[model samples]
Target: MDDTLREDQKLTVRAVLAREGRGFAEEIGLGRTNNPASLFGLLVTAVLVAPRGESSGPARAAHEVTNRWHTPADLAAASAQDVAKELGAAVEGVDRGDGDDSASDTAATLVALASAVSETWGGDLRGLREKAGHDPARERELLTALPGVDDGVVDVYFREVQPLWDEVAPFAGTRALRAAAALGLGESAEDLARYGNRPEKIGRLAGALARIDVEGSHDEVRRTAG
Candidate 1:
C-alpha cells in the first residue's frame, strides 16, 4: 500500500517537473546547472540578488562556486572575502545591464549555504535527497534549514530539479499554479502525481504546464492532450 501510494505521488510531481517546469527553469538558466550542489548554490545566489541582479548572475555564480570549491568542506571553509573575490571574478565576465556591483549579498548567501550544507548534510546534496527520500514535506523542512535559502528558491529548486530528486513535485509558482488548477490538478503536491506515473513523463508534463502560464494559453494544454 505504501509503495503504491508513493509511486502515485511520484508520478504527480515528476510530471510537473518534466512538463511545466523546464522552460521556466531555463528562462533563468537554472536548468543548465546539473550538479545538485551547484543547483543549490545557484538558487541561493539568484534569490540574494533578485529585483536588481542580472538574470545571468546565478549561472555565473554557480559555475564559479562549483569550480572554486571541489567539495562541500572546501566551500564551507572559504572566507567571506574569498567568496566575494570569486563571485566578483564571475561578475566581471557578465553584462550587468545597469553596471551595478550586486554580488555582495549573493556572496554572503552562498557562503551561508555552503556552511549549512557542509555542516548539516556533509556537503553531499545526494545525501540530503537520500535523507528526504520522496517526501516533499521533509525536503521542504531540510531546505528551510539552510541558512540563506528562502521560499522562492525552494519552490524553484523543487520545480527544476526533477532529475536529481525525481520524487519532488514541480512547484509552478503563482502563475503556473493557476494553470494547474485549470487542468484540474489541485494546487497541492499530491494532486500533481495523478497526471503521470513515470518520472520522465511527469517532468515533461511539468514543463508543459508551466508553458501554459508563460504563454497565457491554458487552452493549448487542453488541445494538446486532446
Candidate 2:
C-alpha cells in the first residue's frame, strides 16, 4: 500500500531472508513453500517463544505445544490453568527458575485468546479470513478480541497471513526494527512497517532482520558491525 521503502531497505530485507530462509523453513518444517498459515504460525509461535534470550529451549517448547495443539480451536478447548501446568511440565528440562512461569503465562494467554476467537468467530480461522474481504478494520477488531493478541501479535498476524489471503501492507515488529536499524534504514519496527510497501520488500526486510542475532541492543549491532 505504501511505497516508502528505499533501495537499501529492500536489499537489507533480501539479505536477511537469504541468510535465514533455510533455517526457518527447516525449523518450521515448511520446506520451500511460503504458505500463509505456516508463516503466520511461525510468527505467532515466535511471539510466544520469546526470542529475547536463550531461545532454543523456549522455541522447542513452543513447537511442542503447537504440535500437541495445532489450531486455535485446540487451544480454546484447553483449560487455561491446565494448559499452563502442562506447558510448565513440558519445559521442565529445558528451562530454569522462573522460566516455567513464563511458559505458563504464555500458555494461559494463548488458550484464552483461542477461546475468545472461537466465541467470536465460530471456532474457525476462516471467520477472520472472511472478515478480511469485507472490512480490514473489522478483521483487525476481531483479531484483537483474542485475549493475548496485542498490537504486536496483530502486526505479525496481518503481515504473515495477508500474503495467504491477499496482498496488503506489511506489519513490522521488533525483529524487523532491529534489522532496519542494523541497515541504517530506521530505528524501529513502526518505521520499517511504514516504509515497506511491496511483498518483495516485506520479505526482504523480514529476512534481513531475522538474520541478526537477538542479543544486545540495536546500538550494539551497529558497533559490532563497524
Candidate 3:
C-alpha cells in the first residue's frame, strides 16, 4: 500500500493476492454486509468449511445453502432432509466421503444452528456480538456454543469477517499466521496487516495467505514475488 515496502515483498503479496485477494465471505458473495442475513451466510460458510481438507466442496455447499436461505428464520423453516439434499447436490463430485450419513448429519446440525439463532437472537447475530461485548475471546466462546460450530469454524469466521466486524478486525488465525511466517511476512497478524496499510486489508491479506498454505503454492508465490 506504500512505497516503503521492498519490491520483492510487494510482488510476493501481489502474486498471492492475484489468486485470492478477497476474504472467503466476499468470495462467496457476502461482501462485507454485516446484516443478520449476511452474518447467517458467514456462519453457514464457517460451519461448512471447518475441518475440511479442501475449500471447494465446503464453499459450494455454503453457496447453495446461503443462496437458498436468506436468514436464520428461512433456514430454520426448512426441513433437514431438504437441506441434506441440497448439500449432497452441491458437493456431488467432491468425494468428501462415500459415507451416506455425512450430508444428513451436517444438515441436521445446520438446521439446529438456524433454529438456535432464530430462537435465541430473534434471527439476528448482532445480538450475539452485543452479548460478547466486543471481546474476541468471548465471541469465540459464544460461537463455539452454536450447534455444529467448532474452534475451526470460529477461526474461519474470524478471518473472513474481520473486515466487516471491527470487534475482531485484523485477526489472522493459525493458517494465515503460518503462511505469513513462511512467506517472510512476519510472524504476527499485525505484521502481515502492516503491509496492506489499512485495517480492513488485513482480512484480504490473511485470506490470501491462508490460500497459499492450503494450495501448497509457497514456492510459486515466492518466485512470482521475486
Q: List model 3 lDDT by residue over 1-226, tens digit each.
A: 6667677777878888887687667666664577999888988888887667336667778888888988999999999877877786555343334355777788888899999999998998889989999898998998888899988788888877776678787788888888888988889877786687465688778878877788888998877777
- TM-score of every candidate: 0.57, 0.63, 0.91
Using TM-score as the measure, the top candidate is 3
| Residue lDDT tens for model 1, 1-226 | 1244454344544444534443334444443355655555445544443322223455455656666776667777887666666666445443323333455555666677887787887776666767988687887777877876666556555655665566664444444466677666667444554555554344445545655655666555445444
The list of candidate 2 runs beyond 4 A from truth reads 1-15, 22-26, 30-58, 85-99, 132-137, 185-201, 207-226
How well does candidate 3 score on lDDT at residue 133? 95
Please give the RMSD to the true structure for each candidate, in Å.
7.4, 5.7, 2.4
Residue 45, model 3, lDDT: 88
lDDT digits (tens) for residues 81-155 of candidate 2: 555654554343423334466656777777776666567766565666567773656666766666766555555
Residue pairs that clash (backbone atoms under 3 angstroms), model 2: 13-204, 13-205, 14-204, 16-207, 16-208, 17-207
Candidate 3 — which residues are off by over 4 angstroms? 2-4, 92-99
lDDT of each: 0.56, 0.53, 0.80
Q: Over all chains combined, what TM-score does candidate 1 have? A: 0.57
From the highest TM-score down, the ranking of the candidates is 3, 2, 1
